[model samples]
Target: MKHWRGAVALTISSALVTGPAVQVRANPTAVPAVAVCVASVGCVVTVVAIAGVTYWVLSNNGQELRIPVLSYTPTPDQQLEDWEDYVWADNEQQARRKCNLLAEQYTNQGGSLVTVVRVRRASQRGSRWACTFRG
Candidate 1:
C-alpha cells in the first residue's frame, strides 16, 4: 500500500513538473499591475483626485467660504447673543482664545468690558472663529 501511494505521488509530481506552462489571467487585458491597482489602490486614488478637483473648483471661484461676521459691533447696551456668525476658529479652544484676545482689545480701547457670549466657525477654507462679545 505504501509503495502504491509513493508511486502515485511520484507520477503526479512528475506530471506537474513536466506539464505545459499554465497562464494566469488576472484581468482581461492581462496587465497584472493595473488589475491589482484597480482592485485595491485605484479607489483611494480616485477619491483623492475628486476631492482635489472639488477644492480647486471652489478655491478658484472663491465660493468655499462663509460670509463671515454679519455685524462687527453689537449695538450699544446690547450684547450680541445670536451666534453662528461671530466665531471663526478651527476648534472651540482656539475660538475661545481668539475671543479672549478680542475681549481684551475691546476693553483696552476704552470700550466697556466685553465677554465672549458665543463662538462660531466660518464656512470658508474653514478656520475662522467668529466670537460674539457681551458686556
Candidate 2:
C-alpha cells in the first residue's frame, strides 16, 4: 500500500512539473484595421468640409464662381493635421502673367484683386485644399 501511494505521488509530481502548453495560430491576412479606419474617417471629414464650404460660398456670393479643390496624401515626417502652402513664385512677370486675366476681370468689377499662389512638394502624406473668392 505504501509503494502504491509513492507511485501515485510521483506521477502527479511529473504531470504538475511539465505544465500545460498552448499553441497560437497566426492569421495570414491580419492587416491592422486601425489605418483603414483612420483613412475612412479622414475621407468622410474631407467630403463634409468640402460640402459645407461650397454651401457657404454659394450663399454668401451674389455671383457663383469656379473653385478648385486639391487633395493629396501626407508624408511620414508630417503630423496628421498639419497643412501649409509650401511654394510660391516671386518672379513678378511670371506671377502677373499667370494671374493676369483673373486680376483684370475682378478689377473691372470695382473689386481689388488678391492673388494667392500656393505650391506643395512631393509627399506621400494626405491633405486637401479649397479656394474661393467673394467681395
Candidate 3:
C-alpha cells in the first residue's frame, strides 16, 4: 500500500511538472477611451479628496480660535455696563485664562466687580449688542 501511494504521488507530481503550457491572453475587447479617462479622473479625485480632508484635519487641530468674552460691571447709577472683547486662543482654557487677566486689569483700572457674563464663539455674535448699558 505504501509503494502504491508513493507511485501515485510521483506520477501526479511528474504530470503536474510536465503539464502542457497554459497560454494567457489579454482581453480581445478594447477598453473604451472614455471609460479609461473616467477611471483616471476618479482616481485623481479620490487622491485630491483624501489630501483635502487631511489638510482640513491638521489645519483645524489646535488652531487658534476667536472667542468672544463678554465682561460687565455695575455703573454708579446701578446700571450693568457690558463690554465685548475678542480673545484669540487655541482653546477655551486659554481663552478663560486671558479673560481672567483682562478682568484683573479692568478691576485695577477702577472698574467695579468685573464679571464674565458670557464666553462664546465669535460665530454666535449675531445681532448682539456691544458696550451697552443693561439694567
Q: TM-score for each prediction?
A: 0.34, 0.17, 0.33
Instruction: Give candidates' CA RMSD values in order.
Output: 26.4, 27.5, 29.1
List, residue by residue over 18-77, the lDDT tens digit for candidate 3: 343222111111223312322342211100112112100111233422211122233447
lDDT of model number 1: 0.40
* Ordering by TM-score: 1, 3, 2
Per-residue lDDT tens digits for candidate 1, residues 1-135, read: 011111111111222223432222112112333223334422211111121121101111222321111223445565544322354566789888978887887778846666677776656567776777765
Best by lDDT: 1
Give the poorly placed runs of model 3, Cα more than 4 Å off: 1-76, 123-135
- Give all candidates' CA lDDT scores: 0.40, 0.27, 0.34
TM-score of 1: 0.34
Query: lDDT at 21 for candidate 3?
Result: 28
Task: By lDDT, rank the candidates, best first.
Answer: 1, 3, 2
**Candidate 1: residue 5 lDDT (0-100):** 12
Question: What lDDT tens digits, residue by residue, belong to model 2 across residues 41-78?
Answer: 22111111232221101111234322222222234453
